[model samples]
Target: MSGHSKWHNIQKTKGAADAKRSAAFTKIAKEIIVAVKQGGSGDPANNSRLATVIAKAKAANMPNDNIKRTIDKALGAGNTDNYESVTYEGYGPCGVAVIVEALTDNRQRTAPEIRHYFDKFGKGMGAQGCVSWSFDRKGVIVISNEDEELDEDTVMMDALDSGAEDFSADGPVFEITTDPDAFNDVVAALEKKGYTFESAELEMVPQNYVTMTGEDDVKNMEKLLDMLDDNEDVQNVWHNWQQD
Candidate 1:
C-alpha cells in the first residue's frame, strides 16, 4: 500500500471520537480562518488558499454549515484571532524525521509544548531546517476505489492530462501528485470531470523513510505522534517512519 493510503486507513480504523474528530474540526476551522485572513477574501473563487482549505474541510467530513459559519466569522469585523504559522523539525524515535505544522496565536506556549514532546519521546528537537531539508512539499489527492464506475486507466490519463506530476494505484485509492504550483489547477480539472476526492492537501513528502524494528522505539514513536495530533494548536504532522 502507498504511504498516504496506509496512514489514511490507520486513521479511519482508530474509530470516531477516540480519533478526536472534534479536534480535527477545530484544526480545519483554524485553517479556514487563516486562509481567509491571508488571502483577503471569503470566496474560494478569489482565494486559492481558502479553496484548498474548503476541500480539506470537506475531506475531513466537516459540515457545510460549519464551514460557512467559520468563513463568515472570519470575515466579520473585529476578529482578533490572528494565528501565525510555525513549523518545527525534529527527529522522532529511531531517527525518524518528523515535521509539525501549526497555526497559533501564542507561539510562546506552542513552541515549548512541542519541544517537550520531542524531549520526552524523540531524539531531542532540532533547529528549524534540521530535518526539513530531507523532505519536499507536494500536492496529494486521494480518490477512493468504492466507485464501481471509476476506471483506473481513465483516471490515470485524466490526472496526467490535468497537470498531475505522478499517479499511482495502491490498495483502495488512487494517489495523484502534482507540483505545488499546479495543485489548484489539477484539482479544478479533476472536479470538472466529476471526480470526488477522499482527501486533498499539500504535504511534505520525505525523500527517505526510517525503518523501526525495536519495540520500545515503535512505542515511543506512536506516543510522540499521538501527543502531536492531540494538541489543539497542531494542524498537521508529517513523518518518515516506514510502517511494517
Candidate 2:
C-alpha cells in the first residue's frame, strides 16, 4: 500500500464553492472539449478518454447539464478550440516533486506562467523527466466510505477481481489503483457492481512523500499550488508534498 493517504490532499478543496468551484468547472469543460476532439467522438461509450474526463467532471460535482452542453459544443462545427495537452514537471519547496497537467491552446503563454510560479515559490523549473522519474502514472479511483456503510474487505476484493492493481482503505475512502491502460475497464466493472466514486482519474502518484521542515517552505509550497490551481490552463497539479 502507498504510505501517503490519497484523501489527504482532497481535504484542501473541501470548503471551496466560489471562484475555485467555477475554475474547476472551466478546467473540466476544457478537458471535455479536448477529449472529444482528440478521441473523435462525443459519446463516452466510444471515447475512452472522454469517459475518463466525464468521470472526473462528475467527481468535481460539475452538473450533468454543463457536461452535456460542453460535449454538444465540442461536436458543433463552429467550435474551434484547439487545445493541446501539456505537462510541466519540477520541484516544489523542500525538494518535493511537482507535476502540473494543462490543456492549453497556446504553449507560448502557458509554459512561462508555470515557470514563473516555480521560480517565485521554489527551485526553478527543471527539464522533462527530472522529477517525473519518482512517480508512477496510474488510474486512481476513490470511493467514499464516510458513513462506514461500505465494507472495506469486500470492496478491496471486488476491486482486485475487477482487474485493479492495488487497493487500500485511505481513512474514509476506498482507494483503488489500476494500470493506465486498464483504467476504464476497472472503473466500468466497479460501476456495474453498484460502486460510486468520489474521484476517478489518471494521476501521477508519487512513490514517496516529502515533508517540509521549514515554515517558510510550507507557505511557499501552499502559495505555489494555489497559483497553479487558479490558472485556467492548469488542469491538475500533483506533488509529493505530504499534506497535513
lDDT of 1 at 72: 95
Once fitted onto the true fold, the runs of candidate 2 whose alpha carbons sit more than 4 angstroms away are: 1-4, 13-19
Q: For candidate 1, which ten residues in a row score worst on lDDT?
A: 1-10
Clashes of each: 0, 0
lDDT of each: 0.86, 0.87
| Candidate 1 Cα errors over 4 Å, as ranges | 1-18, 146-149
Model 2, span 9-72: residue lDDT tens: 6467444423578877888899999999999999999999999999888777899999999999
Candidate 2, residue 223: how far the Cα is off, in Å:
0.4
lDDT of 1 by residue, 46-100 (tens): 9999988988787678999999999999999978889999999899988899999
Task: Please provide TM-scores, in order, for all candidate models, with all chains considered together.
Answer: 0.92, 0.94
